[model samples]
Target: MENASPPSILIVGLDRYGMRACVRLGLEITVVCGGRSWDDGQVAVSPEVRVLLVDDHTNPEAVLMALDRAGLTDRAFDAVYTTDENALVMVGILARHLGLPAVPPEVAVRFRDKAVQKREIRAAGLPTAGVRVVDDVHDVTGITELGFERAVLKPIAGAATRRTSVVTSVAELRACSAAYRAEGTAQRTFVLEEFINGEEWFADGVLFDGELLFCSLSRYGDPCLTAVDTARPLHYRLFDPVTEAWAYDRALPLVTAALEALGHRDGTFHMELFHDPATGALTFGECGARRGGGLTQELVHTKFNVDLAECAILVALGRRPQLDIKLRPEAVGGSHLLAGPGLLYDCPSATDVLALPGVEFVRMEWPVGGRTPQGGGTAQRVGQFMVVADSGERLQERFTAVWDWFDARVKVVPDGLKTRELRELQHVLRPEARFGDALWQ
Candidate 1:
């Protein structure tokens, strides 16, 4: 075993974090990716790693052709995996092709395909909101059949809430869908789901062999569908197991059950659920069969000493994480300052942000002369920072102070509304989160 070559993997798409994990594990990595992902994520591949550039990593045919060209069809891969959400189905197919250790291709599609996921969850008798597929995202003539006054519309397999929106009226939906089509999203499949009003929270952890290895819960500041398009900074905080037992008691079962329903095993999971304080019910939003996005790895590591990226790779290679989490007494949280539209300037420096109380890390892309797209999603961030505190109360206070610390220094032009607030107000001002095209930036 000492002289054995490191476990080899065939990756469908190259993610910066995934690549880093592969290096740490000393795996022989072969990645099939499209051209734009290289520059988009600023991913740097080492010479030791094999890179196979294809026209589309998400396309099974293109990936197969790339493999055939590289003469890797018969290659004995230890596993087939992908951290990129877009290429998950393709990875599943490749996993089955190589008879590698990973979820079946059909099960893998459940993580990305909302319709199939919801159906499976429903069949499992889990509480899920009603969903109807919109064969054409641009047309919603049969909206009445959905039997809901308000609904959430998003791509079938989309991530980061790109082009996701809320529709309350037919006119508004038509206009929004028209806008989506006009922006070249006509070919994408979308779905409409009955909107569940409640405080939205998410759980992330590793599950192995149908057993929950570890779990962490966190509550979101606003309905992501509405907050992501506004000036409010999207934020959330991890619930301390000792301090916030209520969240753990309610969320743990749901996360595990839902992951099981989707047939997910031996991997890190990111599941979003809605907690109805009024009714004491949890509704499934969605789940991803990978590590949570953003600085989650850092946040989890800072508080619990768990490396989710490392765990993800280990699980893919059919190995146990054997996770030993040394939970710190302190709590961890993160805030993302998002833009609306127009130009952004005078963003705060990481050094200045680091000076703030409890601030542990900062990652921002908002430069002085950068421009933001119209429909600003999660990706449209001025930047984000992580904070740690001894308790949840102190964490909340620091979360607010971080906002005030940044707002005073940053400035935006053309429309000050784009990124001016730099703080969360929806929770305080509007207890009930509502979404419509009017709120869409």
Candidate 2:
């Protein structure tokens, strides 16, 4: 349907990359966002585009009313899509009502609920940890009967590993459950799964029309649950196809099957998994129904020369994406620079990080004085950056060099800062700054 006016698509949530990619693809777009989400300015939405805010984007009637209010109710829409998990079901609902191209609502629900997602994986004869769901508002002691010595605990919806934990005893389970309940928030439901002793890895893929088009696997520096609390920064290195061909051969099938098991026919998927170092077996962890967050799609480009953002928009518009994994010339890796379980007082500028050799990209996650909470889990970060190298050894060195460089300038106060330090910690938190020194470092 090539025409003077671009084919319009309705996005149910804010996704910066998807919006820009749509512009690149020459598509007309309308966006509907929940009032809280729209106002949060997370997307930093542009006023030039058509956007509608409603009390609830999940309510198709409200969305229609917003469209009516904006005089866009009768506009031709080619697809309904969203990168926000909270909006997937809404997008699916709108897609079904409008007969537009998108993943089915049932499939969307499967991704939203971890219990259903794991059940679907198990049903497909895939290996995933055995899980039991318990409400945080009740006595979670009953899960002890499952007889698993070690278990994993997380919100039923996988809330970015905010409170995810590995429990070795019932006491720990009760403590985590109590913490979640005490929060008095929507994440009162939790899942307990048998913990698998294996290396954690991430799988990113683009699937369209039930056919897998592109997939990439990367090895995490440590188990996700453990790394959130450690001072060590979380890192991941992409599997080089030349030396790690087995990773592709093994994980590609699992990713494809997992998507198929959940009836996720179209769009991109970001999945977590565990791989046994000894046996090479894979355990499905969790999957998200959109592109991986935080430069993942861009990292995909650095490793494979493929743009997942463009592919997602292509399928969203009911168009074919030229999906191909073209090998790059060097090793690629990414890191989330950890700053605190306390106050993050300072960090080097983006330019400071980019000045380091082999640093391809960097973004400071926290501004000066943005505090990271005690036990913030994986959400703790000062920034994220990517680096490239001609060899794997060089890549490791680059990562080490970046960390070493940051250690010199970045500042965090594990113990509460003094009144003056709270006012300014660059002097106190710096590496060379001394407690009783007469001059500031």
Candidate 3:
């Protein structure tokens, strides 16, 4: 008799990255995505890959019903995969309903809600900043009672630092909270946490069967909060495994402890943390049950030669991930391109940027004449690029060179019809003077 067909997999979102994962897994894949058109050329249309269009992929029940209607309910799927943050909780719920291996809905909720995450970490005896969940603007003053002179206020389920702010006084807290509420952009619940003053870093890796398989620690050019506050472009440099012994010695154990506390299992995790230089204390910042954003995955591949997307897909299939955690000699880094508030008339061509020495790739978002949003959060970014070099210094030099070239070459027409030098454009970069704040810097 012919062998039974390979176990079918259901992918909740059909983004380019997810599509690539499906292809890598080489499974009979079914995709449930919102919208009518699949115009993006990233995902190839094939008999092996079926697409089920839905109005909303965030509704788990709707997605499951769509799966049934699409004739995938006759048998159980081997796995369900999704990388879209909006669909993560939905994927977890659907996986539970299907009796598949996935992050538990309760755990997923903690990942989505910062307040819940901090509470869980604290309860697990891990070091986390003091936090309070407030439902109204009036409740924000409680931070002072918690003995915090400065605190961070953000939506419970926000991403990329959207609507996040650092408030040093009761008035700033009240104003920030009130603005969010009045703007109708804030979630029903917001988290207020004592701001940990220190250097910020991120740990990205995969967990297989509750065991940490691979992890890479990266240092950000500036605190992410500062990036949002200053509307500056953000960058991160992956530590050279051979040279950055201190990071591994200091940060990795904390990351492992965090994962253990969070009950992480069978998925990629992106964790952010802070290291206080004065006190030598490592504090948890936040984490997500997915790969790090921007060029993180790419950096992982470039440095460690692992495919996080493929590994995540493998975990979903209940198979062991093929990961080798040896760091390469080269270093990898990337930065976002932010456009000033204006009608974008022109920018350095991706082709030209690609021609720069050590530059690897560039992805542009806004076209000519597109109105650039006032830059602050990650969402306002126009594009981003990644590079690889022999060492961190070389990487920084190349990156700065590319930035200078772009600043001189690109032109933006200001919204008020004013002419401003593109060099005078307020794209965020960490000030060089503050470079000494952290050892890695």
Candidate 4:
């Protein structure tokens, strides 16, 4: 933890999950906060770790300009990284200009955009949800012929499911146009796709020069795309060794094919997927070519005894990271997003929950004086608490119990000192038939 040999690293998108992973490795990290009030999160950097806060409202060009002014450009940092899927291209362009081997900008674009993912998956003969690119409202009528009861619509350059919607009827066709227009389609791009009902999973791993190094698979307690409400709290249990063994034998190769198809040759990747139990079909959703967001970066290290962020830093610095993960370890862990039935009144007993036995860490997202978001993305997550145990199911129970305790204690308030109770709540809610964007009009 000493700064004597801190590895110099540059991280774009201060809120990206990569920070946690790198922190565990004891690297000297410099982050570009971007100065946007909303996108910025409370990132704890060591005194030895440098930070460069960008202008409150600067574009990509300004980001680079700020780095230069802050004297960071003169520093010998390992590599530049970002968790902003939308900024992959920009990150690449910036890093490459500095002669660093950033994540491929072209690959970054292809992975984050659903439209691009669908076409690439199909061309590679990999299984994936049926997707169609929508240029405008005229394309909305075609959904009626498809007759799919549910479909999902999402922005091409979105993260945290911004402006994502699911529709179940022809009458909801207007949502497509409205969603697209809201995204400014004249310049932005989006997609409509058949909503598949199934168990959702996220596979996290590091790829050094296109070779899979260390990886883990985890199951989502609720389907992110189909949940009754996007803000509902959820957890992910690391796939047991038996289950992961199956995936490594059966699914890993397919994933590699997917990586190769996207033209990604290096860096970390967090891929989201859906697997139908009935049909056993693996549908590739999308991927982020950087370290994953949410609690993944931290949980993986706690459970697997490996430092992902350190490896990323070493890779960025053009060094071979020491790989230290055993496929079989005596640990089970999961994370819970703090979701409220109504507007978040307050997260009480949060400290108590963190004090629970087996609880490892609790990271809260709420601002001391800020009101909670009504719905969508990281906004709804007031906090994320993690638990580790001897088995996956046990870990799930510990984490869920914490969420239950918070649900009962937290309240949403409208006025000073006035408190209101939350609505009916469930430990876990899954969205199945509901489509984010309706396939049939």
Q: Cα RMSD (Å) between model 1 and the true structure?
A: 8.6
Reference-based lDDT, residue 120, model 2: 91
TM-score list, all predictions: 0.87, 0.89, 0.87, 0.81
Error of 1 at 31 (Å): 2.6
Higher-lDDT candidate among 2 and 4? 2
Q: Give lDDT tens digits, candidate 2, residues 330-388.
A: 88988877664566667889998988998889877566765764446665677889999
Q: Which residue pairs come into collision in candidate 2?
A: none
TM-score result, candidate 2: 0.89
> Highest TM-score: which candidate?
2
lDDT at 35 for candidate 2?
A: 86
Candidate 3, 359: how far from true, in Å?
A: 0.8
Task: Give the Å shift of residue 370 in candidate 4.
Answer: 2.0
lDDT of 4 by residue, 290-318 (tens): 77777786778776766666666667767
Ranking by TM-score: 2, 3, 1, 4
Misplaced by over 4 Å in model 2 are: 1-3, 34-48, 54-65, 141-146, 341-344, 373-375, 412-441
TM-score of 1: 0.87
How many collisions per candidate? 0, 0, 2, 16
Tell me the tens digit of each residue's lDDT in model 3 across 348-383: 778888998998878875677778855256767777
lDDT of each: 0.80, 0.79, 0.79, 0.68
